[model samples]
Target: MLKGKPKYKAIRILEGCGFHAQMGLEVLEQRSLINTSPNGYLDMHDHIEEMGRNIACRLHPNEPNKRRRLCDKEEIEEVLVNDLGTKATRIMNLKNPSIHPATIIEKLRKMKALELLSVYDADRVSQNWVFDEDVQYFPDTLRSLHWTGYPASSLPKTFQANDLVNLEMTRSCISQLWEDGDRKVE
Candidate 1:
């Protein structure tokens, strides 16, 4: 599970994967593990938050490629630069990435087991970060994705959505998901 409180979409995916987030929330509420913040976000005690981070870090202390999630910019950049991602990485949520979008997509080919990937503006306002080139590939195991300000006119011809359950591209420059090919519809 992720360190911070999961959002609505994440809860839905957790439910799809057989997790009862509502039930867990109830338990947390009963135990005072969380408090409703002024802005409505769940706030966890600092110690609890630290414990969660520690648990995630202890999973594979020496190897980031074995971690299930990569949320840090530097670690993600290092992994991308070194091509160290493995099948163990299931979720990658990047916000305002400084690295080239091309490099990110190019290295994603190695994450064969990636299921949830999001590269969006954290503030939900910036429109500066845009993918200039066509994404040539996406893992066949993807279940959810979010890419804001996608500048390409269409997704890659090689890309397929056979296993995609959720796809959100808000304020993107995309004109179509894919081009009309030399084929017929059923």
Candidate 2:
């Protein structure tokens, strides 16, 4: 592991990812690191939470507390500055995920982390938002946005244009938006 604290550059990245140095023990370890240990999963959660907090703060600066709350099966997408094109800043949106691994893969392909935008699934999709695609390795700052108990695919897709503001959509509605290619800024 790292001796003492992480380097300045690393800290900057961590800060940008919404992680302070204090919450470094809650990260989830990948299967490779999970040799019958408890810290691994905790660490994973921390790291995922940090990423989610950062994304939420960036996307919705006005309400940091509301966005960073912990839970299960949360969903969000973050586009880097270089990828924004006309948009000056990056964009991040939280969304849920499918339970089945096959469905997860399908959703990942459709989300197009390599093409449309990058996607990270922490703790089975919605445990937290992470910059790393490898869900196996988790960092510190465990704070999951996932609170819903249902699977992403099970939720209904009913979020229509001009409906997001008025609608507190369930996982299904959000998934439907992505499935139908209907993120029209409602």
Clashes of each: 0, 27
Q: What is the C-alpha RMSD of each candidate to the true structure, in Å?
A: 4.3, 16.2
Clash pairs, candidate 1, are none
Q: Candidate 1 overall Cα lDDT vs. reference?
A: 0.70
TM value for model 2: 0.20
Residue 169 CA displacement from its true place in model 1, Å: 1.5
1-186: candidate 1 lDDT, tens digit per residue: 333434555456666545696777668878998755554456677899777667876888878788988777778788988999899998887887777666787788899989888886544333444454455567767777778755455565566666676778787656677756522112
TM-score of each: 0.74, 0.20
lDDT (tens digit, per residue) of candidate 2 on 50-98: 6655665675464322333212233322221112212222222333333
Error of 2 at 32 (Å): 28
User: Which parts of model 2 are misplaced by more than 4 Å?
Assistant: 1-55, 60-72, 76-98, 114-186
Candidate number of the best TM-score: 1
Candidate 1 Cα outliers beyond 4 Å, as residue runs? 1-8, 34-50, 121-135, 181-186
In angstroms, the error of model 1 at 41 is 5.9
